[model samples]
Target: FMPASLLATGSERIVSGLFLGTALSISSVKIVAMVVREMNFMRRDLGQIIVSSAIIEDTIGWVIIAITIGIATHGRIELASLAFTLAGVAAFMAFSFTLGRRIVFDAIRWTNDTFRSEYAVVTVILAIMGGMALVTDLIGVHTVLGAFVAGILVGESPILSRHIEGQLRGVITALFMPVFFGVAGLSADLTVLVDPELALLTVALVAIASLGKFGGAFIGAEVAGMSRSEGIAVGCGMNARGSTEVIVASIGLSIGVISHTLFTMIVTMAVITTLAMPPTLRWALGRLPMGEAEKKRLEREEVDQRGFITNLERLLVVVDEGVVGRFAAYLAGVIGAGKPTTVLRTSGESEADPVEAAHLDEIEKGAEQGREAAKEADEEPAHEAPLTRRTHDAPLSAEAVAKEARKGYGMLLIGLGRAVTAKGGFSRRLNEVAGAFEGPLCLVLKPAGVGRQMPRLGPGSGRILVPVNGTANARRGAELALAVASVTGAPVKVLYVARPGRDEPRDTVSHRRREAVLKDIVALADRYGVEIETAIRSRAAAADAIARQAGRNVALIVMGVARRPGEELIFGETTSGVLQRCPCPVMLISDARLRRDDEGREALRSGTGTG
Candidate 1:
């Protein structure tokens, strides 16, 4: 009984519905694609759930569209037609799932076997997606369902899936997805829900939908016997509607089941849920100390299974003819037992062998005299006997040392000794090596008269001194000290020096701040189960304070250094000053040790010692 104009208008509406449904479906996919990449959800449990739910939402949207078409044709939805359409969809989905999986897997295998080009594999994946979409459209189901099904089919195809995902990610995440969400927001009319009753209704709908999702997921997790915190995490994760909600709202609008007002309200709900997810997830996860077993399992499955080594901690051993250097090299080899080991021998034409030999001869003569004097008299000499002269094929050179150490070590261990007196002379050369070397360095001093059989570094050996200024380089030095302490089981002495006139007066804030800083270092030492003694010294110069303290029973000093611009100084000012004055051997950690972004460290941790 409707007019001819009304019939024509109805026909136009149907056509519009088709276009709107297709566009929104794509837009919804864009939302998901964007969020996934931005949040790096590929490795997250919530991401998996979102992907699965997206599939359901897409499938349901298609079913609703088909029912809407039936309603438009018959002035009401025909139950038989609806049943037939659903049956066809179900059958098609099953066939596609089975056959499509095989097709996708075979294509991946072919790509791997043929050209072995990632680009080609990506092209093939896109072809399959497009083909599947066409077939689904021809069969009267929505294209979104086809895309969802295609994604599922390709999911198991490792080669094609990875390739396609990599290619699609940039385009989808950077441009398409954000634009689509922005457009959806622009299209929304917030004024429609201004009525108090409509606003209440919207709130009620949001509450119901959120509860349905959260409760359903929570129940599933509980039934699976998950921990209370884990169950809550799952529930909070599932409550994020986002892209799926957008797709559902779009479908409702297209089918005339929901008006623009309702669509806007639903969109708002989706945005709220999406925005709430990150904070809620963080809270839930923070509440539960993620079990070690669960973390290990996840790490194994998501990270270790990839077989890509990322984090590696290396130990570099630099050796010379001296007993201290040799011992350090041996200790490094022991530390890097299962990891990579690089043995750096400094030997080159640039290094004069005769000069070093003469110095060693002088030291040996001193040792002989000291020994004779000891045997003859009861009074001890003020200074200890020095080391002997030895010659070998390898000469100490920085480049050679670095090249050898780079083989498999993360931490660089260098011997500390004086070129002449066997105390402060070799520290500058060691610092130069630390600066030129690519990783962290640990310097070990061999005391005068200590034989080839090095004493085991332990609590009885002596106290290890760590000078900290809270710099990243200092932290690295601390890490090296900790590693040494772990090996020797030695107690650590942490010293914080406050330069009297640098900024704050020594009597006021600077002294108190220094105390607080030492407290923090002590706390950290405690965490590692090491004995820590903290001190605050007031001096005009950091080096002076540290040197004066070094004279007081500290066997070793660990200090941080950086390359001075346009200068060939082995150590930074503070470290150099300390080395020049301190009687003990000093370890200088370089800027390279503090570079947190170095992929080398990650590679080392993952058991690759390339750095």
Candidate 2:
């Protein structure tokens, strides 16, 4: 028998060990929480895995804690009590699996309809989770099991689950989780490994734990037919114990299963594993061709969703040395600089001619002159005085100039040729710039030598012309045009064409339909707080009617390019026809460019406007 003094000393040591174990457990959890919070697991695959592992570890730790508590209270471990506890846990899980699905689905649907707010739904979900946790804790299973089970149930309700996940993700993953880990690190005492044997044992245990997880995952991957490199990646990834291991260590310490020294060692192991994963993953990924399949899948997905892709906020501007073209290009550049600007060469007159050859001589000459002008402008500090000092009037017919600007240009810019020359062949380019191009046209003219300076329009410079037909593209075009109008404080003219067929006459129904469209335009105009004009014309060709109306005074004409199934016109024939006949600069707006709300707004706002 032991002496009373010796027994008392042994009891004191055991009590001290229990206290140290509990402290270590708490410390481990804190460390894990810190790492996970800092790492932002929600955005990464590793984070997800770490979170999952942590959940499992937490559950196991809680079970051990409960058992330790029972042992301490009873003064001995009872086999029957353990058996009963195990049976109760299994029974509770079975019930949850069966009834939890229905409850979760119904609850989510009800919450969605009643609350109408995502936050409300999240609140309901948390309530259910908390309730489930309470039930599990009362049943002596573990609150963590209940939390996990609740997560699984909620996960089944994809929509609600996604909403709650999104709402909670930042708070839980970014803030609280990291703080917990940092707190754990602060609580850890690294001096416990002063004994050489204890230090070696701790290291061995960490190695064994890491190898067990890594080996299991790698072997599983290999058995599932992964390549050697892929299996290795899986192993390396799984070896990262991280937050989960720390949580497990904490739980063990709380339950009196692990010593303070052992817990510190485990925490160290977790940190090393977490730090090593990134480089190991990079190396493993470099050695594997696993990304090929993923790349192909993403490419296919993009193709499948091509119709949904919106146009970028970019404007394609055509430029040349001609006065009108240069002014238009400069204006476009200024407005679209915040966007994207594409310059195309349109000097070559013939459609059949090779573009490179036709523009080669002109391009080279322009490049040389541009370089010289840039150098002179750079040397002259007061270059802003006036370009007219050295500017020689390059004589060209307005028609020729407009035609050159039309090639590949989304909008045409030209100075209004003298009205006296309007009927004359000399003002052909001005006519085209004003009416012929199927896009927005800017006609700028300065009296002979006074160069046209871009005037700033107040509030209303984004005047746009949107011709709607109720089609998706037409609606998009209208919205885009409106956005532009809003930005520039420009008025919108929504022209809905009602063409009378050669056989059919314009009737009451057509008139009513036209009236409805006008009303819509007016309503939208009012909503956006801009000027709106609606026109319905009886004509043979819808494109011609629309163009004629649009050409009247608008800064830009926005029209949809119709695309049809099989034997489809590559370029909208109607748009091309309008481009050929319209008097104003035409914007051959395609569905491709006006997909996004922002892009649509930018495109519509991108032109010279007279506010």
Candidate 3:
């Protein structure tokens, strides 16, 4: 800046230097993420730190660039121009994050739910981007600011699932990225570099850009108490300006803030730095070894990647105005935590019922509790608002509920008062509701004598009993139990019932498999920051073992059962025995598979189905 300003005659010096420095100082978040991902470091501590720093830098740089452009357009710095630009940008940011964010979220959600057209959400999102960009232009700033803000808010929306994100990204990658880069590339004239003076100046620009970025990042990392290797990796990671710099240079050139020669130099510097970063960053990261704790954390995250409960995008809760209904809602809130939840109040529950109001309050409290626990356990917990609605137009029916389920729910939870019959079998209504949704289901049942008061599911209540049979369903149940226990501060006991008289061979496949199952559950509990006690019963029957555990200070029994091929809502003998014998409330999680054979239909018509 000093050298460039001194060389200028008078007025152009300050603006030229500021624009030049701002252009050079910018770091590209896209390039940083790309390099980090290529090296499989996205989840590691080093990669996270590097990527986060680049994002912060990019955000701040854009703001500075906006201010610079505002000044450059005026030909010189003026208090009124600076003040208007700063005030407009600040006001826009405040509104964007507050009311604007809420409005956008609601709009996107409504579009997703209301539209049956393909790519409706994507269409709405693009429109939102344009609207926001127009707002920034109206405020006398670049539209990119508004577009950037809109992208952040939209990405944070809970409904923007991985599938939808892929669709959006696919469109952008296929259309926008190439077009933008191609235009930017065509605007630059590399022939300017043929002159010896210009060639030397470009080299100087690259050196200045790289050294400034690397030194700043290295010093900052050191100040932050990072290790030497980590600091080196970060410095290398931050030096890539990549496509962000190209965009910045284009903006500068478009607004007459920079000449074509300088623009070409900036673009050249960007290309060189970006192409050099990945290999350098890879080398630095490879020299850094993972510690035991980091290794464990990585393994836990891997489990989470494949775990059923962890990957659930949204929850569909169908509950009534009963104790069981409220409990189910509370459980749903806990398990779904920061994920979007749609609570469909079963028809026939009075809208003015005090129990219904209480149920809503319980859901909020449960969600808050789960959020707090997540804050303690996760480095970056999601803060998405849960979505809830009720239907009073029609009574609860299989067809109506299934219609709601078609909107892409990860799991469905049902808790109706008449879920069980006098003969201890699942009621006909319960079977119909369960048969409607073809996904995982959680059915909550309140015991016969339990009153209107909510059960103490939190601390001081008792332990949570989760029985794992080494199946995927059983592991899912364990994950659900862990989530509840994490929020409630309750101890969890994993009960594994071994077949009696099994061959007692060490290191056998069956034995190792059992050990592995228990080990996986333990790792899962550790991930939730919850301690669990494991119990193995080799002699007692599976049901008896589970029932006995339920009696020992257990507040609730959560079981994962496979749907049996029958007309009735049967989950095999073990589940039935435990449900009949367990003294506490039992929650069953099962896949949505109903064997609807001709004989099964006749059995249902004859009302001759068992639980």
Candidate 4:
């Protein structure tokens, strides 16, 4: 219907109507993103479909508009011109997704490490976008497609997708978006409505575009297994042709594919249709009830949105050249894959010092191995983001570490010798270091090497042991353990320490409490797709119970402990004893007080291995 009506509108300019029609048919991504976010349905099933379809529509619409203009310039859609348009588009898309994807990811990662300066990555991304846009223009397609593809690649780079998003979003929202939209409005003359013939033609044009877009989206939804009601809601939601339509019309006018009269009509149609969308979408969405699966998925995503480890952007490792340091590097590698990481060795030794050099080498080796493990598991890309081999020879003092910590690191991984004193109290030096940082800390503890254990299983895979005692610290420990296990696809054991005889007998009450704790841990592990085994040990000492349970199968033990004020991280007896005697490595995840003001970035303090 749209094609026939467009054909009927012109004799000399047959493809002009086609260009205008395509421009009018596009649904705006900016409009859909705003409305869905305002309604807080951005993560809903239908909402995602609508946004995704808009992205596709925007791409396809630009391609069509570009080609139609080319045909209009040549005065005819010759067979050769048609073939060239099809081939150019196909080749452009193929290169964008394949080799272009790799080049973009690698360039972004390289820029981050080489410059080591702020916004180096942002500079690289913009350059890539501009270069790609020029390439598209040279190929006779619209620059918008190139810019759009560049955005996809930039978003995929894990170095700082979140940080980059925050930075770019602010710049675009505060400056670029308003300027562009405002200029578009200024260029559109609404006085064209005074001409009755043009006004009637404009009305007909809008009607054809609206009905066609609405019907196409509705049919697509139904074909993709959505209900009839969902199809209706999607159609209503997609009727907006706001900013994208305006941009398309502006481009067409500049290229002579559309006249001032047609551009004004299209812009007016865009304003009317866009204004009509939000309320109609709200009403339609209000009638579409949420399903159980969607509700559960959204709830899970909400939990992740608030989670600590889930949001960690970068890592800073302050360690010594020891078994603990190498192990710390390994953990950081697994957890910090595709994230910027800086490793600092505190030995304060010269490059000539063999021990210092060996420790640094070992730490980097372990980190590389861990990253490989993550890559094999498809957890993240290897050698992307801040994959640093640059270890500073600087002193591991609070002043030294804190200076680096202030430079945009979210988590600090501290590994050291003598974390616990002879009396089972945290070493004063550890506290002094940990006191400097206000961010969360992961203290890596190297376990006692009691017996020569057998090496088995695949690379980066290991069994993790976590002790649960219904404490917040314990939950944090289990959370960390679950994350590691999830990344490495390792098995986890959740051991509950039941004292020798507390008289909380194995009756229904005690049993139920124990059951609840284990159930919670199991559920947490399940969320990460990690396999877990639960156990209860009626033992005299919690530390001894946990230590004894760390058999040959367990590769690491993660303990969560609260920090007691004064001078040290006081874990009472259980944690201190675990540090003293456990045969497997113990990682203590402590919730440091995270302070922040109005800015989105976090304030971090210097950290030590005791916490």
Return the top candidate by lDDT: 3
For each candidate in the order shown, give its overall lDDT on alpha carbons: 0.56, 0.49, 0.82, 0.72
Model 1 misplaced stretches (Cα beyond 4 Å): 1-213, 220-233, 241-317, 320-322, 326-423, 427-435, 438-442, 445-455, 468-476, 498-507, 539-555, 572-585, 592-611
What is the per-residue lDDT of model 1 for residues 1-611, given as tens digits with 9 covering 90 to 100? 11232122334445434433432332144444455546555445555555565556556656565445544444444677667667767777788877767677667545544564546666676688888877666665556567667777776553332335678676667986788678667767989677787787767756766677677767887898877777777666556656766765665555554457757877877877777766775676557554575454455444323211112233445556555554455445333433333344444223223234432332334334434433443324323311112233554556655444433334566664443233333445654666555555556654333334444456787677888876656766665565456445667877776556545555876567666666655554543346777776655578788877877776667766554433243445676467567766555655534323458568778877543
| Cα lDDT for residue 466, candidate 2 | 71
Model 1 poorest 10 in a row by lDDT: 382-391
**Native-vs-model 2 lDDT?**
0.49
Clashes of each: 29, 31, 0, 4
lDDT accuracy of residue 363 in candidate 1: 30
Task: Give the TM-scores of the predictions, in the order they appear.
Answer: 0.44, 0.43, 0.89, 0.74
What lDDT tens digits, residue by residue, belong to model 4 across residues 275-307?
989998898888888989799778666756656
User: What would you estimate as the lDDT of candidate 4?
Assistant: 0.72
RMSD of each: 16.9, 25.2, 5.5, 6.4
Query: Candidate 1: lDDT over CA atoms?
Result: 0.56
Q: What local lDDT score does residue 226 receive in model 2, on the 0 to 100 scale?
A: 71
| Candidate 2 residue lDDT tens string, 36-113 | 445433223343444454455555545454444434333345677667666767776688778877777667655654
